[model samples]
Target: MFVGCHVSIRNGYLGAAKTAFAIGANSFQYFPKNPRSMGVKAFDAKDAEACRRFAQERGLVSIGHTSYPTNLAVDEEDMRERTVKHLRNDLEIAEACGSLGVVVHFGHAKGGEPLEGYKRMIRLLDELLHDWRGEAKILLENNAGQGSRMGTTIEELVQVRSLLAAPDRVGFCLDTCHAFASGLWRGSNWKEVAAHMRSSGYFSSLAAVHLNDSVYPSGSFRDRHAPVGRGEIGLEAFSEFLQTPELAEVPIILETPAPAIGGHREEILLVRKLADRQEGVFDLEK
Candidate 1:
C-alpha cells in the first residue's frame, strides 16, 4: 500500500518529485507537459535528470500520467489522431524518465454506448501498444461512469485488456471515487468486490489505485473528487481497501485532499496509520 498522489509537473516536472518527498509518499503521478494544449514545449533535459535523480534518491515510484482532455473513445477522427499522438509520446517519456508507467483514462463518454467507446479505445491502445512494445508500461484508469465514459465497469476494462499486442504492457488503475459512485465497491462489502475483481478475470491487469472520496452519492456517476474522510465515501471504505489482499501489491495514491498544510499528505498518513494498526497487513520495511 504505497501512498502517492497526482502533483503539478508544469514547474519543471521535478516539482512533482519534491512534492512526493514533502508528503512522504512512496510514489507520485504527474503530467510531463500541458494537457490542454497541442503545442508541446521542449522538456528541460536538466529538470528531467533532476527528477530521475530525486526519485532514485528517495526510492519513490514515479508515474507519468497522460493528459485526459483527449478522448480516444470518441467517434471523432481528429480526437483519435490526437489521442494516438499523446499515447506514443507519453510512453516514450516514461521510459526516458526512468518512471514505472503512464496512466491514462479509458475515455470520457459523450452520450455513446460503452461498447462503441470500448472498441475505439481498444483500437487506440492496440495501435500504441504495438509501438510501446516493452519498457514503458501503461495503466488504463477506469472512469466514474459519467456521461459516455468507458471503463467505468470492470467488464469493459477486461475486454480492453484482452485485446492489444502488449497485453502485459498494460494494467489497471482503479479510482476509489469511481468505485463508490458506480456501486461496484462501497460500504463493508468490499470483500465481495475484491473477490469479484479477482474471480471475474479483471485482476490480471491490476496495477495501481487512485484513492479518492466522492462529492456525489453512491450511484451518482459524477466525477467530483473530495478529500479523503471528508465526503460520501468515508473512511470505513478506505479501511476495507487497506484490508484487501489483492490490492497489497498495488500502489494506493491519494487523489483526495489532505488536512492542514495538506493536499494528499493527510490522506496518505491516514492510510498508512490504518495499514500499520491493522497488524501484519502493510509491512513497513524499516
Candidate 2:
C-alpha cells in the first residue's frame, strides 16, 4: 500500500523526496507553492528531473496540493483570473515533477446560494481547463462542511464534475477528517460510506485519500486533524478503511499534526502495522 505524509517542499522537490524516503514513506503530498500566497518560485527543471528519477527508482509516488488561497468559486473578475492562473501554474508544476496530480479545495460560496456557487465553480474550471492539455489531473478534495464550502457532499461533487468541460481530467480526493466532521462518515461505517460514494459515482473518480484522524467528534463540522490513533476517529476506523478493496491502488496521504518528521514516521509505521494485521501478514517490525 502507498502511504506517506505531507512533506514540505521548501528545500525543493529532491529535498522533499529525500525527506519522505527517510521517513520510510512510499508516497507523499506537497504544496506546489506557498499555501497562503499566490506567488510561486521559479521552477528548477533539473531539480525536478532529479526528484522524478529518485522517486521512480524508489517506487515513490508524489502528489501536489494547490495553495490554500485559491478559490475557484469567486465571482469577482480579478480574483477569478488570479485563481485560475495560480491553478494552471500548479498543474504545470505537478506535471513537471511527474506527480500523480494536484489536489484542490472546492472553494467557498462567500454566503451566496450553494447552487450559484457550484455553477461558478463549474464555469471557472471550464475556463481554466477547456483548451488546456495536461496529463496532471485536478483532484477536488471534500470539505469539512464548514460554513459555505462547496463539495462537502458527494452529490454536490458529482454535480460539479458532470458540468465540467473536462470531467475526465478531474477527480476526487477523500479526506478522512473532513468526512467525519462533515457527517458523511459516522466514524465506524466506512463500508456504508464507501458504498454510498460508489453508487453516487464519486468513488470511480477517486484518485487519492487523505488518511487523517479527526480532532472533533463526528458531525462537528470542524477541520482539525490529529495524529493516527490519537484522535476521535481512532486507529480502528483507519484500519478498516485501509483494508477496503476499492482503495487498494490509491495512494494514502497523512495530513495529521506532527511535531516533526519523526511523528509522521511513527504514524506511517502504525498504519502499515494496521494494514498488515488486518491482512494476516507480519512482515513489519514493531
Candidate 3:
C-alpha cells in the first residue's frame, strides 16, 4: 500500500507533499480549503503547478479530502447545502490536481433516522457524478459511530454504494481506529471483518485507509484517535491490514494523535515493519 498522512494544506498544496517526503511517504491527503468553514481558497496557479512538479520529482502521490463539516448525510438543510458546495469544490480541485481520490465523511444523521441520512448521501453523490469530469473517485470514509454519524458497518457503506447502482466511481476509506471501535476488532475477528466488507462488494470499492489506533475500547463508538499500536486497537488489526488484498493498491494514511504526545515515529515504523513482514504474525489484536 502507498503510505501517507493527513497533512495541513493551509500554507499551500505543495507544503503537503513536502511534509509527506519528510515522513518517508510517497502519498498524502490534504484539504483544498478551510476544513471547518467551507471557504474556498484558490491555489496560486504556479503553486498548484509547483506542487505537482515537486511531488512528481520525488515520485509522491497527492490526494484530497473535503472539509470536516462537509457531510453528505447531514439533515440540517443549511449544512447539507454547505456540504454539497464544499465537496464540489474539493472534487474540482482534486481533478485539477490529478489526484486519485477525494476522501469525505459520511456524516451524522442530525437526530433523524440514520438510514435516511445515507439515502440523502446517495442522492447528493448522484448529482456530483452527473457532470464530474475529474478522474478522482469519491472515497466515503467510515466514522467511529460517534453520535449520529453513519458508516459504522460495512452494511451502511455498502448501502450507500448500492444506491449508486454499484458504481465503480464510488470508493471507501476504512479508518482502522474506527474499525476497532465499531466492534470489528472483537476477539481477533479480522477475517470476519474482512469478509463482511468483501461481501459488501468492498474489494473494488475501497480506495484508501485511515491508519490509526483507538483511544477507546472495542465497540466504543467514540471518535478519539490514538497513535498507531499505542491503544486499544493493537498490532493484530494492523497485521491484517497488510494482508488484506483490497488495500494492496490503496493509500494508507495516518491520523494519529499529535507528535508531542509520543509514538508518532514508533507507530509509523511499526506499521511499516509489520506490513513489510507480511504472512506471519501473532494475534496482537487479542
Candidate 4:
C-alpha cells in the first residue's frame, strides 16, 4: 500500500517529498501555494526538475491538492472565475512537480438548487478538462455534508464523474473524516462500503484515500480532523481500509492534525504496519 500524509510546501515544491521521506512515507500530498490565498506563485523550472528527480529516484508518488477556500459552486461570477483559475494553476503545479493526481472539493451550493448547482459544477469541470494540458488526473474529494456542500454522498460524486467528458481522467478521493461526518460509513463498516463501491463500478476509479480521524460524533457534519486513532474514527477502522482488495494499492494520505516536522512519523508507521498485516476479514464482534 502507498501510505503517507499531507506535508507543508514552505520548504519548496520539492521539499514536500523530502518531508514525506523523513517520515518513512512512500507517497504524499501538498498544495502548490497558500491554501487560503488566491495569489499564485510563479513556477520555477529548476525546483520542479529537482523535485521530480527526487521522487523518481525514491519511487515516491506525489499528489497535489487545491486550496480549501476556493469553491466551484458559488453564485458570484468573480469567485467562480477565481476558483477555475486557481484549479488550473493547481494542475500545472501538479504536473511540474511530477504528481500523479490532484484532489479537489466539490463546492458548496449555498442557497441554490442542488441539481442546478451540480450541473454548473459539471460544466465547469468539463471546461477545465477540455483545456487541461497536464498529465496528472484530477480527483474530486468527498465533503463532510456541512451546510449546502455538494458531493457529500458517493452517488453525487458518481454522477459528477459520469457527466465529465473525460471520465477516465477524472476520479475520486474518499476522506475518512468527511465520510464519517456524512454518516455514510464508520470504520467498522468499511467492508460494506467497499462492496457497494465495487458493485457500483466506482472502485476502479479510486485513486486516493484521505486517512483522517474525526473530532465529532458520528453524523455530526463536522470537518474537524484529529490525528489518526486519536479521534472518533479510531485506529481499527484503518485496518479495514488497508485490507480491502480494491483499495490495497491506492495511496492513503493522512490529513490529520500534526506537527510539520516529526508529526506524521508515528501515524505513517502505524498505517504501514496495518497494511502489512493485511487483515482480510472484518469481524463485527471483535
C-alpha lDDT of candidate 3 relative to the true structure? 0.74
Q: Of 1 and 2, which scores higher on lDDT? A: 2
Residues 109-183, candidate 4: write the lDDT tens digits: 878578877877877777778867678888888989888756777788887889888887788888989999888
- Where does candidate 3 have its weakest 10-residue lDDT segment? 277-286
Error of 1 at 129 (Å): 1.9
TM-score for each candidate, following the candidate numbering: 0.89, 0.94, 0.89, 0.92
Question: What TM-score would candidate 4 get against the native?
Answer: 0.92
CA error at residue 108 for candidate 4, angstroms: 1.0
lDDT of 4: 0.81
TM-score of 2: 0.94
Over 4 Å off in model 2, which ranges? 278-286
lDDT string, candidate 2, 1-286, tens digits: 8999999988999999999999899999998888889865678888888888989999999899998778778989888888888888888888888888899987788875787788889888998898778788999999998888566788888888988879998998999999899998987888888888879888899999999888899999999998877788876677788888877888899998886545588778888878766553323321
Tens-digit lDDT string for candidate 1 (1-286): 6788888875766787887888788888888777775444466778777888888887877777777575767678777777777777777777666677888877855677766767777788787677556476888888777776556778778777877666888888888888878777665677787777888787767777888888998888887888776778766667767777777767777776545565766567778777656564234321
Model 4, stretches more than 4 Å misplaced?
Answer: 259-261, 278-286
Ranking by lDDT: 2, 4, 1, 3
Candidate 3 runs further than 4 Å off: 76-78, 261-266, 278-286
